[model samples]
Target: MACIQVVIWLFVVQCSAVCFANYVLKEEPEYKHTLLKRILMEENFESLESKINNLTQRVEALEKENALLKHAPVAFLAELTKSVTSQNQIILFDSVKLNLGNAYFNVHGNFIAPVSGLYQFSVTACAATNHYIVLELIVNARVVGKVLTGDTGYNECSSNSFLVQLSTGDDVYVQHKTAGDYLLANPAAGFPTFSGVLLNVI
Candidate 1:
């Protein structure tokens, strides 16, 4: 009887050990599967972050390019071609012989700044009778500068230039401030001209 009890006890111990070993083996693959899935998720998250960073850099570059294009200089040069001395009140240069920078000078003879900037404006007027050639560089209907010819008589030409900071939509043109018909007629010599250029954009 004592021998039989000992054998039964040994058999029970062997069965318990086998069951525990099978459970560990089955659970190991599941644990490994969970760990592998977690690793893949982390890798995907890192890839998404890299893509976002690249896109952010591209956006910044485009913004800088747009800013540079906006601040680019705009300029124009126009000349009065007709030689006949004519009388006028407020003269608008209708014929645009030379125009640059999107041709801001219009048929109304007004230069409208596309962007705010420091502008240099100049005018050359020829006196048919050779006297003080009176012309005003008007900005927004107000006289800011005037041209006065020093030498008076036949075939005399004088020029005056001014520097001004202009905002967008500021109108710039040439007008006669002196009383009576102002002589601006000289077509052959090509002396009468009005011009403006953007020096720096603010």
Candidate 2:
């Protein structure tokens, strides 16, 4: 009877050991699967972060380009072809040497401001022999500067330069201030010329 009891106890112990081993084997794959899922999630998060950083860099580059385009160059130069002698007449400088930004119109002899800014303008008026001329630089019908070539025995020229604040669409031109016999437009004496440039953007 004692020998039978010992055999039964051994069998029970062996069965318990085998059941524990099986449980351990079944849990190992689940643990490995959970670890792999966590690693993949981490990799996806890193990829998303990299894409966000790249998009931010592209946006910054585009903003810098837009700022550069806003501050482009603006300037012009014009000269008269025919003499102007009448008082209060707008001198038609029909010859355009340079019209940067297309702001200067040779047809009506006007430089309309394309953007608001501080500007520098110059006008050179030439008077024929025995004749005098008074020229005015006008901004929107208001005189900002004036030049006078007094009646001298020989042909003479006078010039005036001024700095003025201008708004967008302001009209700028040279006009006859006082009547005279002739304003020298002859190539020999030198033609009347008007020129302007944007100094700084407002």
The candidate that wins on TM-score is 2
TM-score of candidate 2 versus the correct structure, residues matched by position: 0.64
* lDDT string, candidate 2, 69-123, tens digits: 6877788888787876667688888888888889999888899999888899999
lDDT values, one for every candidate: 0.72, 0.83
Model 1, 157: alpha-carbon shift in Å? Answer: 0.8
Q: After TM-score superposition, what is the CA distance of residue 137 in candidate 1 from its true location, in Å? A: 0.6
lDDT of 1 by residue, 78-130 (tens): 67765423444555655566566664555677888777778999988766554
Best by lDDT: 2
Per-model TM against the reference: 0.58, 0.64
Clashes of 2: 0
Off by over 4 Å in 2: 1-69, 188-190
